[model samples]
Target: MTFLRDLLGIPGASSDPAALAAAARDRSGADPDGLPLAVVRAEDIDGVRETLRLAHAHHVPVVPRGAGTGLAGGALAGTGAVVLDVSAMDRIVEIDPVDELAVVEPGVLTATLDAAAAEHGLRYAPDPASAAISTIGGNIATNAGGMRCVKYGVTREAVLGLDVVLADGTLVSTGRRTVKGVSGLDLTALFVGSEGTLGVIVGASLRLRALPERTLTAAAGYDDVASAARACGDLARARRDPAMLELLDGLTLDVIDRAQGTDHGRRSRALVIAQADGPAADAEIAAIAEVLGKEASWVEQGVDAASSDALLAARRLALPSIERFGKALIEDICVPRSRLADAFAAVEEIAAEHRVAIYSFAHAGDGNLHPIIGYSGEARPAGVQRAADAIFRLALDLGGTVTGEHGVGLLKRDWLAREVGPDVLGLHASVKAALDPRGILNPGKAL
Candidate 1:
C-alpha cells in the first residue's frame, strides 16, 4: 500500500473493489480470484515507470491490464499482486499523414486509433474482431490477428516502434519511425507477444496504409464445411490471396440470423465471404466464386458498402450471438493451410465423440479457426472438460497450435509443454529470469 501511494501518487490505490473487479475478469471469464493488494491506474509513461520501480523494489507481482478484453486469461490477476490498469492513459501523441505513421499511448482503444487514421486517408489494418473495445497495448501484447490479416498482416506488422518500461524501471525505445531499419537485435518483436512477462508497454508508433479506394465482396454458401474448407485449399494452391476470406458454419449462421436479424441471401450449411480491393476487386471476387462453385449450394455477390458491412457484421457478431445460447468456451487453433480440411474434420469428430455442440468459424484465408463449445447448465462439467481436451488434443495431432492469436495465459499453460518441448521451455525460463528475476510481472502467464 505504501509502495502504491509513494510511486503512483494515488490516494485510494489501496481500496477500490470496482476497479479491481473490472481488471480481474477478461473476456475469458476464468474464475476470478485473489484480489490485488492494490490497483494502480497509471496516467502517463512516467507513472508507469514509477510503478515498475516500486514494484521491482518491493517484489510484488504487477499484472498489466488494458480494457480487459482478452479472450485468454491474460488480464486476470493473481494472488498478492498489483493490477496495473493503463486504460486511463488514453491519448494520441502524434499523427504524421505524409509519413503514414502515428504515435499513440498504449491505453488508446484499437478502434479509436483506426478511426483517427482514416481521417488522413490512411488506416491501421490489424483489426481483431474486438477492435471496438480492445486496447492497442493488449493487441500488441497478444500479437492479434483479424479478417484482413490474410493480406495486411497482424498487430506485430503494424507496430513500428515501442516505448517499454523494464522491470527495474528502465525506459527503453525499440525500432524506429522509418519504414525499415536493421541496427540491432529485434527487441520490439520480442515484447510484442511476450504477454507482459518481459516489460510494461508505455507508448508506440504504428505503421499505417493508404485507405482502400474500392472494395468488392461476395458470399458463397456451401453444402457443408468440407466444401468451404476445400475451396480455401484450392485458393491457396492457386496462390490467389483475397484481402479477406472468412468461414461461418450453419450453427453460427443460425445464431447470427436470429440475434442480429440478418439474412445471407441463401440458407447455407457453410458460408464463406471473400473481399478484395483496387480495380481487380471484381475479378478477384469472381475467381473466388468460380473456385467455390465446385461444392457451393448457392453463391451471391454484394457490391455496395451497406450490403458488405451487413454481411461482415454477421461474421463479426458471431461470438456475441452464440453467447445467447449459454456460456461458450472458444478454441482458437491454427494449422497449415493444406491441412485445414483435416483440422475441420477432426473438430467435428471430437464434437460427435463427446456429444457436445461445437460451432465453427474462422479466417479461412489463413488456417486460424475458432471452435466454440457451448454449455447449457452447470451439471455438464465433465462433458465440457472432455470436449475441450479432445479439441485441443486434435489440434496438436494436426500439427496446429492450441492458440493462434490469444496468448498462453493461465488457461493454456498446461498445453505449452506439449506444444513446445522442454528445451524451448527452458529457454523461455532463462529469458524470464534475465529480465524479471523476481518473477513479479504477470507471473503464471506465457512461459
Candidate 2:
C-alpha cells in the first residue's frame, strides 16, 4: 500500500471501502471474488504506466475500468486486484477532418468525440447504445457495435490505431494513422477486442466519416417474428443498405408499449425498424416500406428527425424496460442472418421449456439477438442459466456465435472454447501467454 502511494500519491489512490466496492464491480452487477486492494484514478497516460508498473512489481492483478457501463463484467476486479480507473484521462487530443481521424485519450466518451466531430460535419459511426456514457476505450476493448453496424461497421473497423500500456508498463503504439495498412500483424486489432486481458488502452486514433446528407426511417409490424425476420432477408436480397436495421419481439414491444402507453403491445408479434441515410434516403425508405407491406400486417413511415430519434430511443429502452419484470440477464447471441427466425423459434422453445420469461430483440440486419432472461430473485434462478445456455447452444447450432458485440468477459469464458474449438482455444492461450505472461492484467476475464 505504501509503495502504491509512492507512485499514485495519496490523493490519486484510495482504498476506502466505498471506492473499493465501486471499483471492484461493474455494470454487470457481478459479485466479484472480493474487494480490490484499491482504485487508482489515473489522470494521464503516465499515471497509467506508473500504476501498471506498481501492479506488475507487486504481482497484483489490474483491471482497467472506463465509465463502468459494460454489461459483460469485463471490468470486474478479481480479489486483491487494483482497479485503474482511466476516466480521468479524458481528452480529445486531435481531430483532423482532412485525414478523417480523431485521436483521443482512453477516457473520452464515445458521444463526446462524436459531438466534437459533428462540429466539423464529420461523425464517428459505431454509435453503441451506451455511447452517451460509455468511454471509447471500453468500446474498443469490446469491439462494440450498434444499429449503425449494419452499414458503417463495428468498433474494430472504425479504430485505426491504439496506444497500449502492456503488462510491464511499456507504452506501445500499433497500427497506422492512415486508412490503409498491412505492414504487420495488426496488434491494434488484437488489442481492440481483447477486453482488457492483455493491456490497458491509453489512447486511440479512430476513423470518421462525413455526415449523411439526408436520413429516412420506416417501421413494420408483423403477425409473427418469423415474418419480420423474413423481411430482413427480403430487404438484403433486394440489395438494400440501411444504416440501422432492428427487430423487436412482441414481449419487448409490450414492455415499450406499457412504458409509453402505446398500442404496439396489444397486437404486434414483432416490429422491424429500418433507417436509410444519404442522398437517396427517401427513395430507399419508400422501397423499404413497400417491402414491409408485402409481409407486415402494420406498416408505417419511421421518417423525420424526431421520429427517427424516437424509434431508436424505444429500441434503446428495451433492456431496462424488461428489467422491470425481475432480475434480467441480457444474452447477446448472433446467428446467421437467414436463420434469425429459426433462432427466435428455438429461443421461444427454450423459454417455454424453462418456464422463464425471455424477451427477444436485435440488430436484424446483423442477426445479433438480445434474448433477455428475467426472473425474480437475488440469487440467479436455475431456469435463467438453462435459458442462457440454450440461447448460446442454439446460436452455435445455427452456425452463429455466442456473442456478437459483448465480449466473452467473465460470463461467457466457458462458451469461448465451445465456439472456437480446441485448437483455436489453444491458440488463444498461446497469445495470452505471449502478451501477458505475468497474468497481471484483468485476471479471470476474457479467456
Q: Best candidate per lDDT, number? A: 2
Q: How far is candidate 1 from the true structure (C-alpha RMSD, Å)?
A: 1.8
Error of 1 at 130 (Å): 0.4
Q: Where's the lowest-lDDT run of ten residues in candidate 2?
A: 2-11
Candidate 1 lDDT by residue in tens digits, 95-155: 8999999999988999999999999998889989889999999999999999999999988
The alpha-carbon deviation from the true structure for residue 214 of candidate 1, after best TM-score superposition, in angstroms, is 0.7
Q: What residue pairs clash in candidate 2, if any at all?
A: 217-302, 218-302
* Residue lDDT tens for model 2, 67-99: 988888999986778899999889999999999
Clashes of each: 0, 2
Badly placed stretches (over 4 Å) of model 1 are 1-8, 11-14, 261-266, 377-380
